[model samples]
Target chain A: MFDVSRVQKELTECNRDKAISGVSIALYEGGSDLSHLRGTITGPVSTPYEGGTFLIDIQLPSGYPFEPPKMQFITKVWHPNISSQNGAICLDILKDQWSPALTLKTALVSLQALLSAPEPDDPQDAVVAKQYLQEYPTFVATARYWTEAFARTSVAIEEKVRRLVEMGFPEDLVKSTLDSVNGDENLALEKLCSS
Target chain B: MAPVPASVARQAELLKQDGNTYFKKERLGAAIDAYTEAITLCPDVAVYWTNRALCYMRRKEWNKVEEDCKKALQLDSHSVKAHYMLGHALLERQDYAGGIKELEKALDLGRGANPASYMVEDIWQVLAKAKYLEWEDLSSKHIYRMHKLMEACERALTSFYTIEDSQVQNDCEEIASERLQQLEFLKDVFGKAEQDDQPKEVPDYLCCQITLDIFRDPVITPSGITYERAVILDHLRKVGKFDPVTREPLEQHQLVPNLAIKEAVQAFLDKHGWAYKMS
Candidate 1:
């Protein structure tokens, strides 16, 4: 019952502005299953989350585009509105305020906005909120450190291919395997070894 | 010009036979090699290119299949296999409307040749799929066009049943039936999509959350969530036994027809019938 064509259209529209909007969506594992997706959103500039690339896990329910997409942060980030423990977000647009007119791109843009302006009053992580309100400088430092430590270490494609090739697999196989696993070196190596 | 040597032609024939053997054995890679050799010996022969295209199709290398099929068609414009292969490749590449045109040509050409050589049912099914996929995006805006397309699919199904080939007929029955059901569903959905053009705004509560349409036979879930009866029932049947909006555990029996809201929607529709075009 999921509107696959609508999701496909949203992906095209979102990715067209990836360089400008800093949000991109791709099918999980390059498979045609539209139910599960991997989305990447570059952190907003001039914010604690800047220079970090956040990955979001997007699941389209059967009533998608009608029912709001179920999205959760896959990357660890320290923010008042986002849970450090599980990456659950306390955002209004993602909840009861979601409208049918909004797209995945708009949702991601809202998240980027949320990254820039953290609301301490309605917080997913109470500890983070308390720190944000009581010790503003410490909260900024912690958030920046968390972004640097967790979100900035995405594996480069060339580096992954090189590592896999060094492990005695053919370059073509390494490249293809890396692509299939979305550039995960360990998974690519496992696939290569299995093959 | 001098006549071609008999030995060279015989060598090409021998290679072609070898390719046929490999093709029959399902050794597509070996078959392609043999067909390539046959083409190298006699590039003028369209059959060799068509045979190689068949091997590429088996390998699921659609680009290569399209290229070879194109080459075969250039050599012999009337080759049914080349047209069919090219059409299939085009369809796989998501050129549905273009593929349908090519397939129609293939079917027309096939009819004049050997009846047994043609898989008419398969062609019809692919044609149905191509037609359906082509019209899918437009169905919401053009209900009349969708109705016409459904009629065309019905005609194709009828014509397919007229074919005497039992083997192909049986092979295609499931696909044909499924396509018919799909077209019917689209027709129903798009029929409602016509209401989208309505200028008047119904009250917020009258609209079904699942359909976004003003309620027709509105039903209230046990959780107090109201939905169009058919829409909620369909969601419950196909998706899950949970409220689409509330996600509360629900059952069909838990749904009670909300007569008050239904009357309200009816009164609104009656006053502003032009808005809904209440069919």
Candidate 2:
């Protein structure tokens, strides 16, 4: 059987230091089960993706910890190694090189690292990879534009969390629930009550 | 057996001393031989069998350990080492229920021993793993059964609307309500198991890095990193042939039972069985 207790432990460990780790995990919007989760990563500094708050959808297989957790970008990202259409990442660790030693936090950090150093050679999106290799300036502009369009919701979510916390919900719970609902205050409040 | 001759008993004592020396030096093969000779000279001595069981345990000859421990227990029913070794042997063979019972017996026998004796703590360690394994297995099966019952309830409720007869429909509705309450009760069991959700985190090292759950059977690698035994074995077979962290070439045989960590985990659970519903 897949180890749910281990997933619970990793979730606790990963979210212990959210500010320092620059990554966090929460249950997906409507699911109470532990297998499905949402991961957030602060885009690495000095990269075009920097300052962006990226959301990754995490699905743990039954052979999880033995198998790599399936991760995809929910918030659209423009990187050579990430498919712009569907946000599929072509990272080795998530595939053949997966190790049980690596937690979801490490995988998210690796994703952030992939953002900083995009591998255009082994590309998930050939169009983006071509832009990255042949037209570096255009690549940077498109990546930055995509980040601005899709990933700059950290401040908005923070504002929503502040409002929800003011409404007497616990800050951490409100924060996670608010982000998962995509900043819809009414949906978050409804979801929080049920959760 | 009849009382032994004095010189023959003395020779048996001398062989036991030789076995002790061999055991201390980690020469389990020679220790087993010495203990065998000691048992041959004085078959009634319970410790001679238990000591040889230890040597067998060290060699991972679990069946031999089981046999020797059984013999030791038959000779001296109060032999704690016999129960402990037998329990461990049973666990190695996946007899969790029997292993847990034997470990509990060992615990009952050893709890009031002197401060210098570590047998109580050792028994607690094995007991803890045994209990945890049993709890995890049973709880998961409980969840699966509850889900099936819930699905049955849903189907009955859905079909309740389609029934032409009012009497049958009312009976179906009643059963559906009972099933709903049953599902609630099952959910509450899970809720109660996780009752202490505030300000408690399992210590990291007590957990396997792979699964992050508490160790069931911990095995240490050549590089000193430890993992839950089943997890690491799966990694070796399904993933790669090297250590995940150190990247050192590792084989299945190189993984040694990490008794220290296993004991620590067992101790922790023994103290806080309420946290995980380990009892």
Look at candidate 1 and give me any clashing residue pairs. none
Across B1-279, the per-residue lDDT of candidate 1 in tens digits comes to: 354578987998899899899999998888889889888878888999998998998889999999999999998998888888899999999887778878877855664243346554355456555654554444444656666766786677556655734645455677768767866775677557565534445566876755455564577888888876655666677656777666778898888868788678757754543334221
Q: Model 2: runs farther than 4 Å from truth? A: A154-195, B1-101, B104-126, B129-202, B260-279
| The TM-score obtained by chain A of candidate 2 when compared with the true chain A | 0.81
Indicate the worst ten consecutive residues by lDDT in candidate 1 chain B.
B270-279
Candidate 2 chain B minimal-lDDT segment of 10 residues:
B270-279
Question: Residue by residue across A1-195, what tens digits does model 2's lDDT show?
Answer: 567867887788889998998999999975898889999998888889888999999999998887899999998899999999999999999998888899899999899889999999999999999999999999999999988867886546777788888888999899778768766678999999888
Candidate 2 residue lDDT tens string, B144-203: 776677667666755664473454535567776776686677567656654432225568
Residue A137 error, candidate 2, Å:
1.7
